[model samples]
Target: MSNDDELKQLRERVQYLEDRAAILDCVMNQARGHDRHDADLMGSVYFEDGVDEHGPVIKTGPEYGDWANAAHESVFEDHLHNITTHTCEINGDEAHAESYVMGAMRIKGGKIVSLMGGRYLDRLERRDGVWKIALRRCTVEWMMSGDSSVLASGAVKGFIKGKWDRTDPSYTRPLLLDGEPVSRW
Candidate 1:
């Protein structure tokens, strides 16, 4: 191949990688937003007209955050959305992605924890130099429950608890340890 053609191919390869990375970031950020109950962060991953369908529940992207936070708070004291086994197919400015999700949630009474596995099927588009989900469909693959009574034990109490807000340690910047660590839920 000519030098110019080789350079063009290299640039195209780099752009493809960048696009994939951005799409993965968008997918992961959605899970983080849900875990933290951050409405703005969750909504920012979608386009203005994006839509989300989670089983029988369907809502616009911008409004889904509040609904999701409320639903989660009602049943679980804490929860996490873990993403795994993600695959994406890109074509021009549009892409389709499927991400496996494992949701671990602590029941309100701390007596039991639920483990649910699912997949997020997304149709994403690149607009104005930004990648965002235009449509998302969620599927629940399987679920199970486990005892979480140990959470009330003294050993668990000593650990720094997580918060469903921006105050969570994950959001801490510079991450310097102060005089003492306080467990704030």
Candidate 2:
């Protein structure tokens, strides 16, 4: 109808898209934090008083951050988390979401690898124009084991090595590279 009305509608739509993108980023950032053992970055995804029910353990957001980072460092030699899918429902400043997560890990000083499947049910809220999880309920589906000896011999060339910190190639990799690469970790 009116130009102003159309402009307002467009603005609202943009805001919604922006909110969704930010929320997705927040979710992905959690995995990256875990993979990198970055406790502070992981903690930023949740509210200060947020709750996390991780099946056997229930703790506050801060507590979860500490526990998770510690466990990964002590128990897992290497781990990677993948977010497969998620459904989000936005209601103004409040939102509800359920995201599927898969984790693969190699235990410390061992050749056995494990796979874990789960979902993260989150209650999010926007405060001070920033959206963060207020509560997260984790549901574990299954866990299976595998042998890592097949690939443990040596990593093939042209594959980027993963690190457990900001030093990871994903963080500092350049957009363009010419000639043969020369690096490994």
Candidate 3:
């Protein structure tokens, strides 16, 4: 290959890697947004006209956060979303991704907890030099239940708890302990 051809290939390789990184960041941000219950953050991952589906239910991306927050609040006192084993296929301006997700939710009354495993299937588009989800579908593969009474026990009383808004420590810039309890559940 000519030198110019080799350089062109190198540049394309770099662009491909950059696109993959951006896509992964966008997928991970969804988990962060849900755990923090930050509607704006969640919505930011999607285009205004984007669509999301969870089985029989469907919603526009911009309005999904509010609905999700209300649903979670009614059932779980606290929750977390974990993303793993992601794969992406990029084709120019559009890409598809599949991400494994596990959700651990401490149910209200602290009597029960639920664990759900799922996958997020997304189709993303690069628009105006930004990548965002244009469509997403969620699949629930398995679920289990367990006792969560320990969450309210003294054993965990000293641990910093998570919050459902921007006040969550994860949002704290330059995060320092400051020698205080920080916040609680």
Candidate 4:
């Protein structure tokens, strides 16, 4: 290719990457707000068919919504989700993103509940000129004791730390269920 053509191609490639990164950031922010029990924020991020694989259960759009709302009502008076170390790749109209998420929930008793930390693997699609999550899988890395009662009562807690890159070794951990390692990734 000529020099000018090569430069144009490189610029286009950079622009594509930027667009994908922006979309991923939006998705992450939405998820963070949702984790903090903001249904309105979560609703903005998900498409009609969005699927959430949380822990050992698979939740469809409505199911996920119910779960989120219920959890917010029962455990938290307020919540905040922190997302970091995001890595994303775009392939035409489809893309995949992985991000580290940490969340803290303020419980009714004035105690904080935190889910250790985890990575979110997401499948995104460009639909009607907007990027939205089609599928998402959450992989918990570890948990810390924010509150014994909350932990005993099945509340999750924690904040994300470490690097955010798809090729980072941190994202390679296997999932677990009921103290047993899960086979599906």
Q: How do all models score by TM-score?
A: 0.96, 0.89, 0.95, 0.67
lDDT (tens digit, per residue) of candidate 3 on 1-185? 99999999999999999999999999999889999999898899999999989788798888988889998999988899999999999999999999999999989888899999999999999999899999999999999999888766777877788889887888887787783236764
Ranking of all predicted structures according to TM-score, beginning with the best and ending with the worst: 1, 3, 2, 4
State the weakest 10-residue window (summed lDDT) of model 3.
176-185
Every candidate's CA RMSD? 1.5, 2.7, 1.4, 13.7
Positional deviation of 82 in candidate 1, in angstroms? Answer: 0.4
Q: Candidate 4, after superposition: displacement of residue 4 in Å?
A: 5.3
Q: How far is candidate 1 from the true structure (C-alpha RMSD, Å)?
A: 1.5
User: What TM-score quantifies how close candidate 1 is to the native fold?
Assistant: 0.96
**Candidate 4 structure quality by residue, lDDT tens digits, 1-185:** 89999999999999797768767766775665465444555666667888888888787754575677786668655565678788888887888989888866657675566555888898888888778788889998987646536443434444332222232233355632343322221
Per residue, candidate 2 scores C-alpha lDDT tens digits across 1-185 of 99999999999999999999988888888888889888788888999898888888888876677799887788888899999998899999999989999999998775888999999999999999999989999988999998887555766545566777776656665634553343463
lDDT of 3 at 139: 98
Prediction-by-prediction clash tally: 0, 0, 0, 7
How much lDDT does candidate 1 score?
0.93
Q: What local distance difference test score does each model get?
A: 0.93, 0.85, 0.91, 0.68
CA shift of 182, model 3, Å: 1.8
Error of 2 at 165 (Å): 2.0
Q: Kindly report which residue stretches of model 2 are placed more than 4 angstroms away from their true locations once superposed.
A: 155-158, 173-185
Candidate 1 Cα errors over 4 Å, as ranges: 179-185
What lDDT does model 3 reach? 0.91
- Write model 1 residue lDDT over 60-157, tens digit each, in one string: 99998999999999999999999999999999999999999999999999889999999999999999999999999999999999998877776565
